[model samples]
Target: MTQHRPDTLSHAPLGRESAYPEHYDAGLLYPIPRAVNRAPLGIEEGALPFVGEDEWHAFEVSWLNAHGKPIVAVARFRLPAQSPHLIESKSWKLYLNGFNQTRFESRQAVVDTLLRDLAHAAGAPVAVELLDVDDAALAVTRLPGECLDDLDIEVTDYTPRAEHLAVGEEIVEETLHSHLLKSNCPVTGQPDWGSVLIRYRGPKLDREGLLRYLIGYRQHQDFHEHCVEHIFTDLMARARPERLLVLARYVRRGGLDISPWRATPGERPPEPLRLSRQ
Candidate 1:
């Protein structure tokens, strides 16, 4: 492994030239300190405004057994929002690829090593699980709620505008979603596509305005977790909803997809759903 250390996302090796290493190297993983992006959201000091966790599904995990036979498994990692850092996606890919030729004593041992390594990289405890492809769920599902894409509206702005989230007193509960939630990577400027679902109670949010606000993220550049937190904070500040649940499911890049979920205090997260695009 190289001794180089990168401090920012742009300095990371995602868009840079690289080849897979021949051995397992824990140092291959890079972590982005949460404070870097959280600072801009005015959450640099105190407690986070929401409760949730970021879920990662790795679809391309493989390694070798003691007999030189190939072993394959899917991995799921859940990183809490309170973590001090988030693992860089490309670095994660490199780290996983490093395990290609390595042998483990047992699946549990592999799981334990992965848990320890990822948790250390994230600066927080991360829950991890390994599943066989035969037993893993593969159903393609859509976000549950009303589809806002059918709304008739004209959109010209492609930047986040908190003013677009208008709400009125109605005390009704509804779930709204849009498949047009797209953003760009802060480093490589690569387009990130995803679907977002908003479930809330209190004053009803203007569906047209909500769709416009989601569309505004077209040119936005930020991390997936930061984007979800940004949306949650915006809604809390503007609509003042009594209850809110925000989720962003970005498509898989580099054989991995990230799902960030935030909800009102004491609320359990919904079932994990896989989409065709994921």
Candidate 2:
């Protein structure tokens, strides 16, 4: 097993689209190879490291017209999990900013162009909904304070009888805990930090292996949502748990903290546990 190291990622302004590989198709959604897999470490099941979520920044972006006037277009984007190209969030942000200086004859043109560009970039079917910014209602805000760091954690050396345990089978369910800590932009190497939680019920999972897997992402570079999904899928595939829930509550960045949860449609995730930046 490799020893953990302090993160040393640096941050810089966004760059051109050509800087990244064109794996995602503009018309489809897909998954890419993850940092956890690339990292040098042996990951088993239970002892996965935890990284807090709430460390991302989305500018609550607005578009401007050629006359430098603000133009409001509400959009909802959905990218397929199987798309070839995974549009980097920073690049997406920059791409959205580009529209600020450009002109579109109508709101529909703006929406269509954005959907097309995003879909093409992701290489998957990307969905977008356009509404008047003033009329569009934002999703409910769950966390409303400076990120809290006070968490009562209980760490147990979990041992699974099976080589792998089933997912969502009370793998470790008690108080909130973080597994791994990692944050980085693929294009600029800007680091984003967060804690992760894995709750499951089935068979007992291997604690040490899970920890190793979490620590393995120390040097990984990926977005928060992608990271959470990657963790969820990896566990599902490796453990084959009967039930599983992967929820990441990232610290706030740019006035927004994204929390992505994936589980059986009917399953309900616990309330968000907001963590402070370490």
Candidate 3:
């Protein structure tokens, strides 16, 4: 195992150069290596080295073969949280494009097969929608909220780090912010940029410690959702707050901006709001 030093920002390089270009085809689908399938869990539940929700990013998506010619098929899909299989989004995107040169008997067949594959990977049923040009308007919705640009917070540094926090305090309110923003595709290492927000209620958290830990991910490689989950779990253990929420709004990549939210059972996430750069 390699130990990451706080001062060594360059120690862990991000996956940037591998980012796929916008015009890349979507027919070339592939699977993640079995070795990398290790569940990104820590030594124990709520441990500091927590695995975030963004690790499940995947899409085996594609469009129908209109006119028997390969064209980009706009697709929208939703995976159930109950699924055991989690598709890596970067891999999904690549997988979808892998089909650009391939042929399908019908759009329904394509959709059905994709649903089965994604469901298997997610360990739950998945839904997919093929969008026509007219349906583009309804295909995607903008996230809810004010832009995060110009939304600045005081930065501080703290120490005495532990692997996790023990649950104790009943958090009434809290705010966590980080400016260490960088975006990179899981497969191509292309940069996907954005900001993150964490709010909860419980005991008073070490503001400086939280900020330092958030900044520590400056060079870390992972998806937006995964990053937020990692933060949420880490704080849950370290701060042991009563209620917690994690939200991450990433900048647009390939005409799409992904924001993921997760909380304890019965917890609700705020509506997706647009941030400044969004």
Provide TM-scores for the models: 0.96, 0.53, 0.59
- The residue-by-residue lDDT of candidate 3 on 159-256, one tens digit each, is 22334234334545755555455645554556667666766778876554454565555556665655665667677777766677776767656445
Give candidate 3 misplaced runs (Cα > 4 Å): 1-62, 65-74, 80-85, 98-110, 131-171, 174-180, 183-192, 206-209, 223-225, 254-258, 272-278
Evaluated against the true structure, the overall lDDT of model 2 is 0.49
Clash counts for all predictions: 0, 68, 56
**Per-model lDDT:** 0.87, 0.49, 0.51
Instruction: Please give the lDDT score at residue 71 for candidate 2.
Output: 74
| Rank order (by TM-score, best first) | 1, 3, 2
State model 1's lDDT.
0.87
Q: Judged by TM-score relative to the true structure, which candidate is superior, 1 or 2?
A: 1
On the 0 to 100 scale, the lDDT of residue 59 in model 2 is: 37
Model 1 worst lDDT window (10 residues): 1-10
Per-residue lDDT, model 1, residue 101, is 92
- lDDT per residue as tens, model 1, 1-278: 45435357666767788888889998888888888887887875358888889999898898887787889988888999888888889989999998889998778878998999888788889999888876546557778888999899999999999999998877788888899999999878999999999998879898899899999999999989999989998999899988999998999998999999887787545685888899
Model 3, residue 173: displacement in angstroms?
A: 3.3
Candidate 2 regions exceeding 4 Å error are: 1-60, 64-68, 73-75, 130-140, 143-181, 195-199, 204-219, 223-226, 237-239, 249-278
lDDT comparison, 1 vs 3, better candidate:
1
